[model samples]
Target: MRRLTAAVAASLLPGLMVIAIAGLPVPAGAAEPYDAYADEACDGYFDPLLLERGSRCSGSRERSCPTVRHWTPRRVSRQLPACEGVAQAAHPLHAERIQSSYLALRPDHGAPRAIYLMLHWHRATAHEAVNYLHLQDLARSRGALVIVPDVPGNQWAQSGSRNINQHVAWVDAVLADAQRRYGTGNLPVYLVGLSNGAAMAMHYACARADRIDAVMPVALPMYRSDLAACSFSQSIGYVQVHGDSDRFVPYRGNLWFASAEQVYARMRRNMDCVDAGAKAARLESPLTPVDIRYGDGCVGGRRGYLLRVENAGHTWPDMETLSGRDRNPYGLIARNFDATLQGYDLLQLAAGR
Candidate 1:
């Protein structure tokens, strides 16, 4: 008789009451089922301040009022779990400071064959150098590891800026890091730079010629006074390109910069090139006229090239069309010859690839 009476009472009440009487699992912190349903249901009661609900109940699930939830903070125990075993000392993070910041790119499909250390011009970032030269293309084609490092203050150490030894150390550190991490054992190092960066490359290459394989300096603005400081130990593959109409770093010479011809002559003299074995040619292209002068039969069988672009000025040839914030406002860019392509070609030529 008591069980029948209880069943009849349960049938008259809500389903939640039935669940509570049956002792089924319910969500913790849940309110009384009757009150919760009244709060969550889309009934006729509406508040003007509440923009979410309609004036009247729509009887649609989409228009239904949201259920209110109360969250309580979980308590944390001071004791560690027994399964954690003995506590060990936490290892602290240690950071080593480097001199310069750099951007590096490696080929996706193959092991890198060589390391190309590309230096950027004064007041420019590594990103600009990579974009302006389309260096990724070189990485893809030659399977070369390209690294563009920004000099401190975005300017390479020069006559009066900072200590040149520190800059040299930075370059050494970059090479060491690359070799250590990538296992670039016995791989050739190619130094490529432009303008102020070009001068830096020349300085470092001269200082460490035995380790470097080749160097290509474009629009080099070498100081005449600094010539006495650079003592070339051994000649490597040397290539330079300068615009005849470059006003910034004048083609002939300037008050502060040495003439391109003079610099080329100095390189040849240091390399001990035999003039009789030198070759000269003029190539006419739709973009610009190129005068190529190559000297061979130097000490250690070294080679040097000087490419003079006619009517071009103070710019990396064929970079105007590239997408970047850099603008050649100082001089005109020659579309005829691409310096980036020539750089890779010359590197390959030196490597006998």
Candidate 2:
């Protein structure tokens, strides 16, 4: 649960580039799994070394290497349950005039192993349901009962309405409704969020830590100083993702919230990690693309992770071409790797699955 031997980590930078007398990029076809398109399309080309270590290439000439490997048809097919389609639903919240909506997605064919709640970013005024289906799709392959909810009135609960008390109550109602229809008696619940929604997930994990088994928050930080009401009474494994180059959520800790590193440090403390004794693991790519720091001697089956994607923006670090989303107007998404699976696998580790 602590150390993830990611395939790339196992590969260990095969065949170090011994430069020619005249300094230049290594000659073409110099390695076994050659980077087919180093100059123009290297970022897009799929690398098996990135996802699973022993997955032999299917040898399909039609395959595109533009994206990373975790979501590959073969590996994903093996990792997730047999799911050909997603079941959708919309249930009313509270039954009063003050209403909330949610989308429920189940695997095409099997009993789910767990329940995953994916919260979307603040919508402001975007009430359209279609704007949030992508959130369900992001977690569809995980073979969980995925519930994606829309924050009523483009907000996760009024800010001054006694903080998370209102938000947590609303969440409990939504989950209870979803479970009545598709309940799998006491399954571990995993929460995922992005941007503002990430803050909500963090607050939920803190306020109601007992109810949550694990949480994955991407690109958002909370004001730790203000969260005295929140408690980590239970050991909860958290896998957080953030871009150092994020423009919207500054990587640097502000007066309001703790920075990404600060959050990880706090996680280590909660998980009982040795003080400042964390060890960093990396995939030796150009500029050290992936850095995973292990919190040594974490007690109570708890895990803490920090996936620092270099040069990544405020968007999720997924392939833009396949996902067809430039979430940010600036098109600053970091597509060189798959951050989704990185966090997903970490959640699995945290849950002891």
Candidate 3:
């Protein structure tokens, strides 16, 4: 239940759906079913009122309504699953943290490629928006059109001001535009993101799971809650990358969010709710150790994956090993992992293409 279509899961929004990361029993004080998050009967459990309209149900699944969400100021002050003061420095390395209120996109190189929707991390700048352009050549090589966009002002804007809904609607418009302008729009749409953008990708997929085919998130999570709340939603192929060495967004998680392991566990239980008994296993990648688990329980044909970067840092899992010294507080990118190629391949599997 995409709440990833493989990449998303958000705060007011939604964990990974799988790959043999780790298994976890439900957390203490965790909501039972997704609807179990409903403590007050203000409106229908899934209705827009409780679900949206400031129902206050979005904070923690344990609460019946949404906790008053404070606006995470864009740029340096972004409110997210923060990295304990390390994000501001760690971010510039991946995508410049300068705030950009609008989105930027790169046209699909050509035909014979699937259309990809790529989102940027929170508080990213327009210039930084091109950070993932390296995937451009790679995607074209795979006959896929990559649409990398800076999330409006660096975030999908998770707020009860009807802000998140509006942002999602805006994305809907953008997808429609991509469909009409780019011929590849009709092709299976795959979402990919880094960090917070990855969460956005997953949340967007869950809300609009019908249209999404696959999702690839690196170093962040948000996907299982909705599945727990409403297992009737569509299944989506899920995959993610995480590093134990990451001080920021560490593999070790918190109560509000999940570590890579917890995300995988939650996904498994959520799938069980729908009777999709996807099993787990270990698989090795060229760069590092990974686990490839599959079952008929997930969306787009019950496929799932997870790449556990051993002793890596707050960086994109790319084929290159960044070794130069930088002033940023966060460290360097993990050396020798091919996120680009792997992402494309995962999408293929997710879409069963």
Candidate 4:
């Protein structure tokens, strides 16, 4: 599983831009076929690529692209198995009550190939995450179980956040519940997040690397606090996608968050990867090609990649439009690359498929 042929790698990421990392060969893996929206008919007006973004095909009088049906998400709510905290004086064992509902999306049929955990950004809900990433459709297509939990107050815990221990415990409980219910035996778990949620993903991935095989954190940098606290014992593959123009979570360091360079350095330290320089991957639109950089020869066959979306903002990259509730107030959206698809592809590579 050390190397993948170019043809094989290309098959996994159909119609997307790619450039090989310097000196590092692509890992062996095949993307599970994603056809959840394959049946929606593409009209003459819109390109077929918009389907993955969960956009309804808006075509003209003449049909041009292939027909497909979008898999509408049915938001299912469930209570996570309770996590116990340190015993109090009167109560020997206390079950931490989770008042918020978590969302789960399962394949229509068959056992899941893997489990995907998605963390939404600050001030965002689980449902908004579904619409923003369209991961529900990915779940349906890949026969994967996707779980999204609503963090307390729509904010994930950070170093300054209250109940940090409790928040981590709740996340562990959610993974346990999802594994028992939908995970195939020994399924590889992948974690993906946006903004503050991205920071949380980095935190949790290092804290509980045994549970997560890889992580994709989009639109935010690693927090200085998180870097101080994180120490990875296992190889949890790391991939970051950030827009350099993101004002809300600046690619450069703000008061709290570290710069993109700092984050990448930390990831390299965690995985023990040697220097792999920037490689340009041109997309359909040459004006906004993604700049890819990574570390190679990481410990335990791991890798870390940072995708710098040119001139992009806080919004998810390369999508046609965001739903009203999912719009980002901070930055401009890049229309050249698909962040969701790129994240997923990177996740699979990290997991060794």
Candidate 5:
């Protein structure tokens, strides 16, 4: 039941790793079945060109021709439902869907104070779902809407000029929808991403700082490879989190090169806060109960927080132990951290601007 495995770890790229869990405990209370708007049998739904590549089709295929179908609900349990909800929302938090984009929204319990747009890693619908659920539960408690978009090919950032226009278009649609639904006046908006999604979030934050209040890129690489066009002129806050023992995106440089901390430091320096102070500290959680803290005070005194868990690999921090695979007793760490609270805290810091 342990999620992290040597085989899985070995399959990951230099800056990223994948862990599979047998089963994680679902949240208390009866949860609804994951739903999708797209035809489950449709080929080229998420990746139109994927069909041409002759990838294996797990789901039912209508035509004999090779066609990629929708990733199953169970295969991508965490993301499908939320994406369905967002894409179907009358007033999406951010934007509308592009031709192949998947969008969904988790409505806030009470009047929302702000909106959060979350991006997921490569083909990691289940992780995205779990992360979304944790965030939704937290945001609903605080009255904030959460939006999760399944980017085409899971590319949230405009790396090459290839799909850049399409990516921006989708974001524009979602943001426009969010503004129409939730008055943009003073409602703070935040962008968060994990792994590849983190890269996308950083790309967006740098390029379109006007749209987001803060950016959190988790478990991304250090070199900032394939992401040079991202703009950093705007004054958007950033929080970078990574594990010290992460084999995927290691603390030290890896075979693929540049570490995540290095990338974050470069971004922080670009923001004109290179001389900020650093504080090493520890955080104790009921689950993992480990000592960890970040090198505080990055750009603008916003200090980057890196939670180094000894022997911990690439996985969401502070997550409740659902399976034996998750060694850290503390549940998803990010889940426990109230993003709304984080948003307000960042807003206070940005208020001086």
Candidate 6:
């Protein structure tokens, strides 16, 4: 497993610069992906061209030329089985279904203190479960139960009003079932999501604050629709992880030309914590320069932490191995970055808050 340093992470920014150069014109009638309240023409804040090129681009220059036709949702859905297979292999402890599954791991000693509700990226189910397991193992070591449920249709962000409400209902069912089985008061519940799933987690936090004590959204897009109804106060402790070189979610900013920092700033404003102070810290990583910015500039006493990986793409920070050829850069990055450590940090923040 190759580790990325800050210098390495910084080097990846040029790729984004190139994507920005090849920018696409915003579609006139594009429906916002998440919130239905937004204007239909407001095609998210992130650049679809950059995301498509960066995420799907591959091979040598001649071999990597853009396809003549655009991708359709149906086409993407056809690729879901591969991702689901990966998830199943990664977390054998978890029970699988057509749309979702559950992974259970018990601690070596005492009862768990918290239960993590892990969400997968678009078109990716248990295939990405290994990454979730890495965190689950750490949680188990610390006496925490990890619950990962697969969202049917591989939908994370509310694609529409119906999907949003359906997701909310599913979440409610899961929580209710968990409570009935394990006595809700015994363990704190936390939510974590990656990529579009991150956006979904934000939506969940906003709509179901009582169910989540904290949330960590990684490599997320900055879509106005996603944040349209989001009230920051509901997100008691928010930890966002992003890579500066992420082509899917560029560090330079979104199609709206807003940087991730700016997006968080907007979120802080919405949460009524606009005056919170931000402090910077470094994270342990084998690859890329990882820095964490935290403090109370956004929501009064409440705090937010942003993990920025320099020169990194759309991947997790510290994983041991790359799962597939098409794995998100940030997910690959997670091999080196410890989600367990992140989970613990969330626990601490939740305790303090």
| Per-candidate clash tally | 1, 5, 23, 8, 35, 45
Per residue, candidate 1 scores C-alpha lDDT tens digits across 41-62 of: 3222211112133222111122
lDDT score for residue 38 of model 6:
27
lDDT (10s digit) by residue, model 3, range 1-353: 33222232332111111001222222366434233223343211221123224442211121111111232223212221221111111211112332323332332333545766777665554334333224433343455555554454456654223466665666676666566655555688887877667666656765776677767777774433533442215666666677666565667764444677767555544333244555544322222334344444554354565667664555565421112221113333332334665456656765556
Listed in order, each prediction's TM-score against the native is: 0.68, 0.69, 0.60, 0.69, 0.62, 0.63
Please give the range of 10 consecutive residues that has the lowest summed lDDT in model 5: 59-68
What digit string (tens of lDDT, one per residue) describes model 2 on residues 74-147?
33211222223555556667633347777676766777777777766554212121222233343345566777
TM-score of 1: 0.68
TM-score of model 4 vs. true structure: 0.69
Q: In candidate 2, which residue pairs get closer than 3 Å at backbone N, Cα or C atoms, i.e. clash?
A: 44-65, 44-66, 45-65, 45-66, 46-65
Question: In candidate 1, which residue ranges exceed 4 Å CA deviation?
Answer: 1-99, 320-327, 350-353
Q: Supply the TM-score for candidate 6.
A: 0.63
Q: Alpha carbon lDDT of residue 22, candidate 4? A: 20
What is the Å distance of residue 29 in model 1 from its true position?
A: 90
The predicted structure with the larger TM-score, 1 or 6, is 1
Error of 4 at 240 (Å): 0.2
Lowest summed lDDT across 10 adjacent residues in model 3 is found at 11-20
Better of 2 and 3 by TM-score: 2
- Which runs in model 6 stand beyond 4 Å of their true positions? 1-101, 131-133, 157-161, 232-235, 256-258, 274-277, 284-287, 297-301, 322-336, 350-353
Candidate with more favorable, higher TM-score: 5 or 6: 6
